[model samples]
Target chain A: MNLVGSFFGSSIGRKIIMALTGVILIGFVVGHLVGNLQIFQHPDHINGYAQFLHQLGPLLWVARIGLIAAALLHIWAATVLTLENKRARGGDYGFKHTIQATFASRAMRWTGVIVLAFLVYHLAHFTLGVVQTETFKETAPLNHYVMQNDYRVAGFTVVKAGTDVANVHSMVILGFQHKVVALFYIVAVGLLSLHLLHGFNSLFQSLGLRNAKWSWLLHKAALALCVVYFLGNLAIPGAVLAGKLRPQTAKVAATAQR
Target chain B: MTLRVWRQAGPKALGQFKDYAAKDLNSNMSFLEMLDVVNDELTLKGEVPIAFAHDCREGICGTCSLTINGKPHGPGKGIATCQTYMRSFHDGDIIVVEPFRAAAFPLIKDLVVDRTSFDKIMQAGGFITARAGSAPEANAAPVPKGVSDLAMDAAQCIGCGACVAACKNASAMLFVSAKVGHLGLLPQGQAERDRRVLAMVHTMDEEGFGNCTNQYECSAACPKTISHDFIARMNRDYLGATLRSAFQPEAASSDGGGA
Candidate 1:
């Protein structure tokens, strides 16, 4: 493995991993954003959506694990390849720069790290319920609630209801409602967009599909997708904070035994 | 007029740019011809003249390599330094000349870096491995004219380090692509096509050349105006070869060393 390590670390190797894995991750990101966008449709729609994912049983967990593994592999390879790239130039100066490449291609490593940080914070605040502060506030008021011949404290807010003890929806709302946190989300999404723009173009280059005519157009498509995802995700928190969004209400139904 | 030129005593020695004043130089002389005049004066004074590389004074051979006034092969498209005329510069112009400064092309003396990695890449490409039999009639191998023309066009790459020098990342993709395409164009070179691309690209990485981010400086600085389109072709070939190798899982790896 050590002997042939150089062969695997070449530009060609980097391109192969980048292209094959890039398409997979892009598909996942698009689907994930679309799924996340379900919040605007109806209030209880998100809960039902979450329930559908939960009902997948072991397959849901399998998908989660697979995503994490793929993300890690992609990041790891990118970091190694970037380091190798830096080491190749023996500290020299030149007046003329390569004019064909774009800024996104240049800042891929930095943007990638920022996106990784966003992912970790996102998972922690929403999935782990580590920081359940004053953000997840109750909007609906009720004097008392009766359920199954028993009285219980009830609020519009969702608690940690999943198998993982995570109140993801509440966390998302709380995090976005804060002005500073919302700003961070906006910036992070911007950086992510930049990363994706270059990444999408370079993905084609790595795949050896550098057709001059259509390559730029592909870059545009990638940029548009990134913007759509960013804006779509950003709108949820922005609307929630603006008081335009409220907790979804469920209608009571008569049971057969009633 | 004095020109400040980068002079490296040897590979492992500390080097600096030295200025030499030529009191009188012919305005009609070629840039390199002026250098010869300087060398003659230095020899008369029992001093070592500045060393650089040049062969065919014509523009065809890419041997006369230099970064003149910060441009590879002395500022212009489709030309080497040897082909550049002194008329391009004013008599008092302070010219700063230096050899190619790439780790992959370490300086052996004053202005010559060891560009043998190029030759090694060509060797790995198996460019000279075909059987020496009777020449097949040109019509028998009537490749599509477009492919044949493009292949012939790419075959014009002279193994010069200008592309590496001009690249900000010091990528050697342009040079390697030319080699990969030279063989990949014809049917005779088809047998080892997969192996050739894989080997040459691997050697490029091992030699510490940077990745091709599709920065077209290599093409711009090329004396032959070698199109970056060839790079795209090389990349496609490399990916196809790698995928084929993966599916077949054969012992198809080649054992060759660098230039």
Candidate 2:
């Protein structure tokens, strides 16, 4: 086998792959959550943010491709490792008892599958606009370069036309307003939280980043990160379902059209 | 005391728990001695006695391995099956005894298992190619106190297979880590440190041992109380070895040049 192939074929090598890919995916989720949180600010804020990403053009596609690769690698490594573990176990114990493994750790595979399913549904609901509620309507593409008077690149004014700028702020609000969709999102986020709870610390361990001195602190940090992600992501649907967030006002939509 | 012991005729035979009453058992007797009493009675009655693995009954030998009441080496910590005493249990208490379970350690009989896999892993790379000679002076190499202490801590693993039985995934990571860390920490073993770790881990995987989940049950159930820290240390070393082997395969192949 080639050097790269043999390295990846080792158990530790596979774990390192999972860890690296996992960190990248976690970074994307945190960034996505922060971007989505702009829905509470105003319709212009999120729509403008969306337009900014659209204006990035090729750079956005690169990032999208990178994220897809990372997700695929993470899932692939996880599946191989899980299968190897099952084979290692050979068969169930005549009598079994667990001493230190937590519920989240034991259920990591199932929770991971749920998170993957949720990722697909999330992409369809907001990114593709294919799974929107009946009241949902697509917003016209924003010409962000022309719309933002202060937009600049490297101290120079750049004028460019932006296309396919869906008003994601309104879409998010409308989607969460549906009780079933909101509940599904909430449950999915819960499972994601469980996955992150075990996965975050596991990533550190798999990458050989943990030691006796730092293990406790790293575990706490992982738990805290999971909680932050859970609460932050959950707040959006919670607010929308409680009627605290409403669809874009007609005045706001009209101003964007101009 | 009521002894609930696992009974199996052979490797492929069906196993089941059979209860036996231990009448007139002395509280001062060791756990195995009590079993001996029960076996003596079974022999007098012309029934096949319960088969178990034991040697050097003082606990240094790793052979007397059993999972007692769902915990390897009985309920207490840092002691082997033979070291357990009857005084640890109440007079009327019911005890459950079974062999250590793992895919790598297949059942041979009632309580004996084929632990030759561990031996095979050891054979893969668990040694140094040092020349045999008269004993050298203790301070010949001048190892630091802390390094020797850490090496001693890892060297306590007796290959009892408790770690495998304790792990939910049946991972032998703790055992392999112990072996790797013990030798890798010593200056003399440095010649083959990288290669030894790689070969042993490879053999461990080949033996069908599961991957480490970092649950710490292995350390908890260890008869020698081997720490889980060794597993992390082994992981770090494994990563370093793999990367070095990938990028500098020729360099790792030298094996300290002289040796």
| Best model per DockQ | 2
Candidate 1 lDDT by residue in tens digits, A1-258: 122342355676765666667777777877877777866764334544554566678999898887877787687667766666567667565334443456777677788889889888766655553543433222111111121111112533222332232223444554576677777777887788788787777677667776666766886787788788778867887787787665432221111012
Chain A TM-score values, per prediction = 0.75, 0.86
Question: Which pairs in model 1 have colliding backbones?
Answer: B116-B259, B120-B259
Per-residue lDDT of candidate 2, residues B83-162 (tens digit): 88888899888888888888899999998888899999999988888889987888888888899999998888999899
Candidate 2 regions exceeding 4 Å error are A133-164, A250-258, B249-259
Candidate 1 is scored at a TM of 0.79
For model 2, the docking class works out as acceptable
- Report RMSD for candidate 1: 7.8
RMSD of each: 7.8, 3.8
TM-score against native, each model: 0.79, 0.90
Task: Please state what fraction of the native interface contacts candidate 1 reproduces.
Answer: 0.50
Top-TM-score candidate index = 2
Q: Which residue pairs overlap in candidate 2's backbone?
A: none
Question: What's the distance in Å from true for residue A131, model 2?
Answer: 1.1
Poorly placed runs, candidate 1 (over 4 Å)? A1-11, A94-98, A131-170, A226-230, A233-258, B1-4, B18-48, B68-71, B84-96, B126-128, B246-259
